[model samples]
Structure formats: structure tokens, C-alpha cells
Target: MASPDLIEQRQYAEAVLGGLNIRPFRVDLTDGLLFVPKSRIAVVRKLCKHFDWPFKVTALTSSS
Candidate 1:
């Protein structure tokens, strides 16, 4: 389960990023994980920090 603070952060992040035409995705159902593209990481990080949300960057790997 996600904390209330985290949920609010995600809602705000979605609105801001959506307004900028950058689509964010909830990549993990179990954790309610949200992510933007690598190209937008800096902007996302900035927003997260400004909003006082914990942010981490993780690389995605494909299983061939």
C-alpha cells in the first residue's frame, strides 16, 4: 500500500507532467509505481524535490 503522501505526490506529478504533454505511467501495479521517460528524469526529479517527495532513478532492462 502507498502512503497518503506518496499518493498525493503522484497525483500532482501526473497533473504537472500531463500539462507539459509528457505522459507518465504506472509501471508496477503491486506498488503503484509511476515513471516518466529517461529524457524527462531531470524535470521529474525537480518536481519531486520541489514537492518534497522521495525520488529515485532506476534503469529499465529487458529480458531477452
Candidate 2:
């Protein structure tokens, strides 16, 4: 599936990613984006919601 064709949608996404100085990456499902900034994680989460995409945060324990 793909997002609808709309300029505003693109601009909003670009602004969000730009503000966080980060990028949205999707190389594969199992091998997801790595090392996204903690500060930018929230924005990523919100964008994922707005776009109806799944954004998952894997919690790590010190033992790992």
C-alpha cells in the first residue's frame, strides 16, 4: 500500500523529520531502522500514527 498523493502530507512529513534531524528508513521488516535518536522517537511515533504506519520501539535491558 502507498500513501495518497498530496503535497501537504509530504511537507508535513518532511518538516517533522527535518526538525528532528533524522530520517525515516525502511530497509526490511525484520531489520528495522537502527539507532533513531531518543528525542526524535516521539515525532516518528506521531508521524507513523498520522500515516497509519507501524512504529515499534524495542526495549533493551542492560543484560542485553
Best-fitting candidate, scored by lDDT:
1
Clashing pairs in 1: none
Give the per-residue lDDT of model 1 (tens digit) for 11-62.
7766776888866433342454446665776776677678675655333334
TM-scores for every candidate against the unseen true structure: 0.60, 0.41
lDDT of 2 by residue, 1-64 (tens): 3234433444555566677667442212333322245555666776667775433533222332
For each candidate, C-alpha RMSD in Å?
3.6, 6.9
TM-score of the candidate numbered 1? 0.60
- Candidate 2's displacement at residue 1, Å, is 16
Give the Å error, residue 61, model 1.
Answer: 7.2
Q: Give residue 31's error in model 1 in angstroms.
A: 5.7
